[model samples]
Target: MAGNSDPLTPRAKLAVTAGKAVAAASRAAGRGSGSVIGGRVALKLDPDLLARLAQNLDVVLVSATNGKTTTTRLIAEALRAAGPVVSNALGANMPAGITSALAGSSEARYGVIEVDEKYLAGVARDTDPKCIALLNLSRDQLDRAAETRMLAENWREGLAGSKAVIVANADDPLVVWAASSSPNVIWVAAGQMWKDDAWSCPSCGGVMQRPGDDWFCGECGFRRPTPSWALSGDHVLDPHGSAWPIHLQLPGRANKANAASSAAVAAVFGVPPQVALERMYQVQAVAGRYDVVQFEGRDLRLLLAKNPAGWLETFSLIDPPPTPVILSVNARGADGTDTSWLWDVDYTRLTGHPICVIGDRKLDLAVRLEVANQQFQVCENLDQAVQLCPPGRIEVIANYTAFQDLRRRVGN
Candidate 1:
C-alpha cells in the first residue's frame, strides 16, 4: 500500500475525485468525457489513480519517447483478441492514469499499460509489472526530460530491480545498450535503412555502426542479435498521403514502426504474429493523433505535435503539402508550459509553402514560419481559421490543448 505521508496519495485521491466529478458533470450535461474539457481533466487525473489500482494486477508496462500509445493500444487489442486485457486506451502513460484505467476494468489476466518515461521508475516501484517494454528513446521535451543520456541512466536504475521480462528496441542504441545487462530481454529491430536518429552508442560514448539492419558499437562491440521480430522492405507504400493500403488509419513511418513493436510484444504473449498483424490493420488512429474527420464538407486531419520528432514525422507524411494548413499552437501548462522545443522542430521543411496559423500562440507560430522563410496567414481565432480552410481537404497540426479546442470548434 502507498504510504499515507506520500504526497502522491493525497494528490491521487483528489485527482480521482475530480475525475469522477467531471464525469458526473459531463453526464448531467448530456455529454461525455470525449468533450474537450472532460478529456483534459480525465487525462490529468486518471494516471495517478491508475497507478494505485495497478498493484492488484499482472501488469505489462510500455514506455518510450515515441510510439508508447500506439504500441500499448496495439498490444492491448492483440491481447484482447487472445483473451481479456485491461489497458489505458487513451494514451495515459503515467502511473496515476494507468492506475485509474486499471481501476475501471474488471479482473483480467493481463494489465497492459503505456507508461511515461519520467514516471516509469515510480510506477514500476508501485506495480512491479510482469513485463516491461522499453521502446526507443530520443530527444524530447528537453526542458523536462533533460537529456537522452540522463533518461537512459534513470531507466537503467529503475529497471535494475525489476524481475519482469524486458522487451527492447534493438535498433535504438539507447534502449539496446541500457538493457544489455538484463538477462531476459527480447530485442525487436525495424530494418537497417530506417534508422533515423541516435547515431552513437549511449554506452562508453562509442561510435555505433550498423552491422546489418541492426546497430552495434565498434568500440565496445556491444552488438545485438537480429530481433526476434522484424519489419523489412517498404512497409510504407504511401509516404505523401494518409490513404495508405497498410490498413492503419494513422500515416507515416512512425505508425508503421509502432505497429511492428506492438506485434512483437503481442507475439511474446502467445499471440501469433499473423493474427496480431491482422488486428493491427484494423487499428484506428486515436483521437487527435492523426484522426481525419468530416467537418462542414471539408476533411479535417488532426495530427498531434507535442515534440520535434512527432512534428517532423507528421510533416513527412503530408508530402506536396495540403494547400492551406491550420497550424495551431498552445503552450498551456497542461500541454507543456515550455515552448522552446518548437525551435527543434524542422519548420524549414515548409519553405516556400503557405499555411494558416491559429490559436493563442498564433503569432508565435507565424514567427516560426517566417523564420523558416515560409508564408502563412494568421487567424485571430480557431473559428476563423476553420472557416478559412479550403473546403475540399484540409490539414491541422495542433498541440495537445489546441487539438481539443479545434476539435470542439469543428464539432468532431
Candidate 2:
C-alpha cells in the first residue's frame, strides 16, 4: 500500500501547486500554522479536491467529542502493517487539515483521518470513506457545537445512505443512536466511562435505566446494542467470545476504549486486532499530548482536558498527594468562548494535591479551585509556574489553546 506519488488530474495538480506556494509564503511570513492556510488555498482553487483525492482510496474517518486525535493516530498506526498511510498527524480535525494531509501524500492508498465532530457528516459524505468510526459524542465546544442531540440527529441523517461500514460504540447511547441508522455497522462495547451526556434516552427522552454496565430506556425499548467486539477485563472479546489480550502504552482507561474502537475498524480493513494493538502500543503522544518533556527546570507531562468528560478521565490519571500539577485554561475561540464547563468537572479530585493555575483563564480556575476547597497558586507564565513546582515530574494539564501554548513553551 505505497502512496500514489503519480501526479493527479490537471486541475487538482494545479491547485496543489498553488497551495504549496501559499504555504511557503505563509511560512515565510511566520503565519503558517502547519498545513492550514495551504490546504485552505487548495480547497479554494479546486472545491472538489477532497472528494477527488478520496476517489479509489481506502479511507477511514474517526470522529468524537474527545479522543478522536489519539484514536485516529491509533488507527493510522495500526494500518501501518498494511503499508503506506497518510493521516492528519498534527491532530488537526478540520477540512483544511484533511485537505492538506491528502494533498501532500497523493501516493497514499489508505487515509486515516480524525474529523471534527461538527464536520463529520460533510467530510464523511465527501470522502466516501470505507469505514467510519463513531466514538462517544459528549457536549464539547457548545458555543461552536451547540446541542449534542442536534449533532447526533444531523449525523444520523448524514449517514442515512452512507455506503461505508460504521464502526460504532454500542456502549454510548448517543453514539448508538447516531450510528444505528447506518445499514452496515460493527458494534463494539468499548466501555463508556462518561455517562453524564447519555443519561437519558435520545429517542423517547425517557430516563435511561443503568442498573449495571448495561443501559436501557424504560419508556422506549432502546438499550445498549449487543456488541461483536467488547472490552471484558484485560481482554477484548471477539464475536466468538475469544478473548484478545489488550494492552496500550497510552495512559488512562479512556485510551483502552480508544484502542478497542480503533481495533474494530482495523478488523473491517482485514488487519488483525493483535496487530492493531501492537502498533498502537508504540504511540506515546498525539501532536503534543501525553508527552513528557523538560521545561524550565522541571519535567512536565502534558494532558489536554477539553471538556468535563475528558477532565474526569484526566483527573483520575493525575498523581496523588505531594505531587504538584499545573492546570492551564483559555477561553480563546478555538477553546470555545464559554468556560462554564469547568464547573461541571469534579475538581475535588485534587483535594490534597498542590495546584498551580496558568493561562488566560487562570483567575477563573483559581476561583474554581478555591471554591472546591483546593489551594492553588496563579502563575500565568508556564516557565515561571514550572520554576514554582517541586522537584519532580509535574503534570501540566491544560485546555485547547493553553495546551498548545504550553507545548510551544516546551519546544515540542
Q: Write down the lDDT that model 2 would get.
A: 0.86
Model 1 misplacement above 4 A: 1-52, 191-200, 207-218, 222-225, 234-246, 351-353
Q: What tens digits encode model 2's per-residue C-alpha lDDT throughout 1-412? A: 2244553678889888888788888878877355888888889989888887787579999998888999999999899888789998887678977888888776567899999988999999888899999988888886888688888998899998789999999988998999988899999998887888888889889999998889999999999988999887667777777787777877888888888888889988889988888888889888889888977667789999999989999988877887889999999999998888888888899888888899998888888888899988998598778788877789989999989888777889
lDDT by residue for model 1 (1-412), tens = 1233333466665765566576568768866442334334644764445445555566788998777887888778777777778887777565445655665555566788888888887777777777788887777655567688778888887888568778787777778766765677877664322244567667777877875455677897777665665554334221122222234666777777777677667766777666776677667777557678887777878878777766777777764654567788887765676777777777877664458898778877778787887878898886676677767667788887898888787777
What is the Cα root-mean-square deviation between model 1 and the actual structure? 6.4
Q: At residue 79, what lDDT does model 1 achieve?
A: 77
Best candidate (score: TM-score): 2
Which model scores highest in lDDT?
2
RMSD (CA, Å), each prediction: 6.4, 1.9
In angstroms, the error of model 1 at 62 is 1.3
Q: Candidate 1: global Cα-lDDT?
A: 0.69
